[model samples]
Target: MIGVVSNSRHASDYSQGVRAMADFARKCLDNWVLTVNGSFEQHQKMIRATLAKRAYELFELRGREHGLHLEDWVIAEQELVHHNLNGNSSGFCILVDCPRDPGIITILSVTSRSLLVFQSRAMADHNPELIAVHLLPENIHPEQTAVDAVDGVLQVHLPKQRNKRRK
Candidate 1:
């Protein structure tokens, strides 16, 4: 993950913001070791907690209105998930569950508005490769983005681009 950030405008230029995942793999294979405790269940729990807090806030905002609990929860989920996907200026985090093993290689590409994951070695015999592409909500600061893989999960921190204020 130690490489010069490129300034290329090409869509394939994954090196512009985040260091290529290939570099991470190479370093890990050589000597770099990352020890982190994370899992898909943990990610789900956090999401639920966030949703609950947001729903409660919405309830309070509505003057503590009754009989709209389900509605509030739904609205909160929509807002948070949409905001996370659409790109809020405050940024967001995404968690991906992936197996961590020497035999598997995961190639990832990230840009200002999207994330692409391609697993070279499929975990199952029926599938030769696994590919996933996610569209971001809005433009992001690729350089400020961070990604971590721990305990069969990947956590990507996407920082939204700051608006330049004119004086």
Candidate 2:
């Protein structure tokens, strides 16, 4: 009778462990779906704004020479799209080793005029490799922001600029 009781107890414990693991797995899946959906929406918005900003920069780069506005805009859009697809920006890529678990790899916090990237620790720990590219607004200076690698993920804080009204 004692042996049967011991076996029964062991079985109960094993079943409980399995149920707990299943619940955890389900939670992780839900979180992953939400993160991916959010990232896609944010990326769409950023791409539009970034393309316009880059086009303007290109126009300025050519000494403000006239008649190439359309060309500049097209080129800027193409370049930005290509860079994002390839995950390689000329000089704006940050690489870090992250964990395989996914919770929130890239978190974009956007206000009226600024954007911020916040990364979670779990997302940084098991991936073993991570690449992050940050695009800043035209008016904000890069020198004004700060980049820190905490808990294996890169965190960038971009302060927003207030536009002064002209009288």
Give the clash count for each candidate: 5, 10
User: What are the lDDT figures for the candidates, one per model?
Assistant: 0.51, 0.37
Q: Which candidate is the best by TM-score?
A: 1
- Cα lDDT of model 2 by residue, 4-64, tens digit: 0011224333222211221211112211211111132344444555566778889899998
Number of the predicted model whose lDDT against the real structure is largest: 1
Alpha carbon RMSD to native, model 1? 14.2
Root-mean-square deviation per candidate = 14.2, 21.4
lDDT of 1 by residue, 1-167 (tens): 11222234453322222222322222222112221212223223334665677789899999999999999999877764433353345996777556555555554445576555544342333211224444566777655666677777777777888788999
Instruction: Please report how far candidate 2 places residue 107 from its true position, in Å.
Output: 7.0
lDDT (C-alpha) at residue 124 in model 1:
34
